[model samples]
Target chain A: MSNQEILNKLRDTIVTQDIKGCEAAAKEALEADISAFDAINGGLAVGMKIIGDKYELGELYLPHIMMSAKAMDGAMGILTPELEKDKTTESIGTAITFVQQGDIHEIGHRLVSIMLSVNGFNIVDLGVDVPDETIIDEIKKLNGSKVLLAGSALMTTSMQGQKDTMEAIEKEGLRDSVKIMFGGAPISQKWIEEIGADATAKNAADAARIVLKLMD
Target chain B: MTNRMTPPERMMAVMTGQKPDRVPVVPFVLGYASKVTGISLGDFYADGDKCFEAQFASMRLHGYEQTPMYGYASMGAFEFGGEIEYPYGKGQGAPFVKKHPVETIEDIEKLEVPDFKKELPGAYKQADRLASRCSELGLPVSVQVGSTFTAASVIANTSEFVSWLIMEPKAAHSLLDKVCNMFINAIDYFAEKYGAENMLPFDGGPSESNTMISADMFAEFAYPYMKRIHTHLKELGVNSVLMHPCSDQNKNIPHYIKLRNEIGWSGKYVWLFGPETPVKTQVEAFGDHDIVCGNINPSLFITEPYEELLEICGQNILEGMNSPSGFILAAGCEFPPNAAPIKLMAMLDAAEKYGRYE
Candidate 1:
């Protein structure tokens, strides 16, 4: 098969959520001498963008996205080693994602991480119920690098954690370097503005778009 | 100015499909009660008397027409023998599942309907106290009959349970069935204790929303079991039901309407919708038969200016005022626990200013 045909197979595996088929397709792409970078950009990332768009259109749901993520992971497992060997696997930038402190509702956080990672952003998922200090510490470690910090809170009580993290970030002198994006059931553009956040996403796809724009 | 009917009388008028003096404003205030009333969060949840008193105090202080109630969103974990962390620290809300009971698929078989008398003595005792207090005050007794799918998520890891919907259908159904039965049992206990006729079952399905699951998934994983529970509620002679289909659930609205129609719960049924579903849509859908309670954006209470809140509430009231059943202005979900008091007052003021019936 031609290289384009092999790449199409790789993309098909992700869209269909064929987990085992993804690994086979990734290997086929490699065997056909398709560059891992091309296979991902031409194949997997294209498929993920489709998934993201479908999700935004409400044609897909969380479980489907998750399944697609698994398929992406399956393909990435086979392709990452090759991509790293070619020294072309560098990420666009780093993103820190977490559910606010005292809030463990993390489906939103996971979705953001999945969208960002597949879109070539390195994701540092601090997991759920992450403390404000821990988030600030992660931001501090990134130092002078431009970082996208996405925090979410599912409850009204936990929403204050985002504000606390913002204050902590500014105090550490990392405010200018970090662009904070907050989203959740209780978060709105008004809340984001009130808290001085850089952006607020309506959904995971919107989150990727917001992060991409901010990064650019 | 004095109203023709008292708050309770106004609520009853609306519940029974008669136009009230004005639309009742019932914000879904929970832990916010503890915070605003100076009660410790731990005491508010763990102590039923304090919980009841604090909620009452908050209502009276705020001067809203809502009755003080007791229940939490994360209802299954503690009842199922999993540990839960109460919101005692800053930026915390309701009790969350600290440890899920079913860690492995093997644990599914071990799951059983816990005896509220034994396994959850604390919760049972607290609920009993709450019911008794409500009965003493002639208020509707609160029953925690929230969504089984949500509880099932709490019974296991949420992501794991969600994946089980696709990867392990049988396991997901098994867990869902168990939680559904568990909720039914809890309702039965409350019914037997408080008398089902006097009890009001408050159910919110946040995990079942389109944000997490699709309408197709809801039909498969949530609808059948929810139907069973609502059918059981109908059999129990419970007339009043309040359901909050939380967040972006326009797709699932049909299933909910179907469930209500199937059970013939056309009267005294309240749908408190998230802002995602406009109040106009809710009234258009269910207004002919049942009370449509809300569609206010709860987040607006904290962030939006007071005038903006008034406009939103005013628009909702205008859309819902003409429903055949009735309408009550309420927050789409639980009013944010830390939302401003003035914003809540704005909600009530909007109802008073525009909710008056001719």
Candidate 2:
């Protein structure tokens, strides 16, 4: 197949959420002399980009997003090793991310984690129900002089976990070294200020802009 | 004058575009009440009497005007042959998906509209028992039925639901049609049990905001099904429907207001929880034709100090105060189940102190 054909095939296969189809098409791309980077950027990435846009447009739904994300992951499983051989980009910085301790709703923060990593940032996704101490400990272990700490809490009650994490950052005397940001159903600029968070984000796209600006 | 209106009268006043005796205190508190009543999360969901008692105790204990219906996410969803896994172990958060019943698009075609008495016996009992108790006390019976999309989302999982919208639009409509049928039946049941006049027909779910879908998507999926429910009731002469969408669903506010217009909600009778929509935009869209509640950040109840909580509440009231239809002070969404007692008390108390109209 031609270069354009392989890329089109890759996009179509992933959109169907056929795992085997993705693997085969992705393999076919590599066999067709399409660079692994081109296969990902042109094919798999294009599928997810459409999914993300459609989701924002409300043309699509959350299940489609999960499926698209899954498809992207599946394609990467077959292509990452090949792309890694000639990769040359360095991560921008480390972002310490977690859903605040006791908050079960996690898709909000997990998406931000994926965006940051995809944008070439070293992402430490601490996962859900993570406590403050563990956050501080992760930042410490990173051995970085500066880091970004992100917390997400969907429940009004669990938002306290964001504040607690902030307090822990201060209690451990790491206040000056960290930038804390939060997002969730309940989070707002007013609440962010009241809780002493450095910033608040609406979604992964907004988060990337905020994180990049904060880094600068 | 606002402070002197009776609780029900005050609520009624706001619903009619009249000045309330004061700002109405209407917080959704089932989750909070369950923890306070010391019921295990599992037991709390499983038992109807306990659910009713918890809500009754919360009203008695907290003293808010709104009667929060203690409904679990799974209460109605599980009635359709799905498993529900509530957080039972130590420090577990909220209940979550163990398995989605509609694993394939074909499953959507196979399922039937759930019968409340047979399919959702426990939820039906809770509703029946609570409606009776509230009726005895002359309280308007309320049931917080999530939107059909939310019901369908749980039955099939959000991932499957969204993908179905893309890969299988036919199945998506089929599932939504089934869920909507169940809702229409449940609505008729409650309307008969309690007077439909007193019923709010709260069609709540994730679609209330753009966090789930764009306005066009909501217009395609949620608007049609939700409008059907409201229209069916309106044909029976019920004119109002209250929709609760969460987060900063500002983008969809105009669309929702438009949908509410179609749903036959008018004046202060139909209220939309204004999260991020500008006050001017709200007045511009519906004028004095609708009621607006909240945009208050719910997290303050959990994490903010009293003074900040009061400040945010005051700001929300002031913003909504300028609306032509009217404003009611409520958490932008449901109060955090673990919200501080003081904050919950302060919600009503702040209205008394700051939301008074001469």
Identify the candidate with maximal lDDT.
Answer: 1
Per-residue alpha-carbon lDDT of model 1 for A1-216, expressed as tens digits? 888888888888888888999889999988888988989889998888888899999898888888888888889999989988897567778999898888888788888898887788878999988987888789879977768888888888789778888888888788888888999878888778888888988888999988898898
Poorly placed runs, candidate 2 (over 4 Å): A1-25, A32-71, A81-106, A121-151, A162-182, A188-200, A210-216, B1-3, B34-46, B72-76, B87-95, B117-119, B237-240, B251-255, B258-268, B322-325
Could you estimate the TM-score for every candidate? 0.95, 0.81
Q: Estimate, for each residue in B34-134, the C-alpha lDDT of model 2 and write its tens digit.
A: 77788876565556567677877887786667764645443445657666666554334445555667888878777877676554443566566777777
- Candidate 1 chain A has its poorest 10 consecutive residues by lDDT at A83-92
Itemize residue pairs with steric clashes in candidate 1: none
Task: Please tell me which predicted candidate would have the highest DockQ against the true structure.
Answer: 1
lDDT of 2 at A90: 52
Q: Report model 1's TM-score to 2 decimal places.
A: 0.95
Tens-digit per-residue lDDT, A16-119, candidate 2: 66667888888899898888878877887676655555655556655556666677777788888997896674556888888876665666776777666555
Comparing only chain A of model 2 with the true chain A, what is the TM-score? 0.81
Residue pairs in collision within model 2: A58-B214, A63-B159, A64-B163, B2-B21, B2-B22, B3-B21, B208-B245, B267-B289
Could you report the DockQ of all the candidates, in the order they appear? 0.73, 0.36
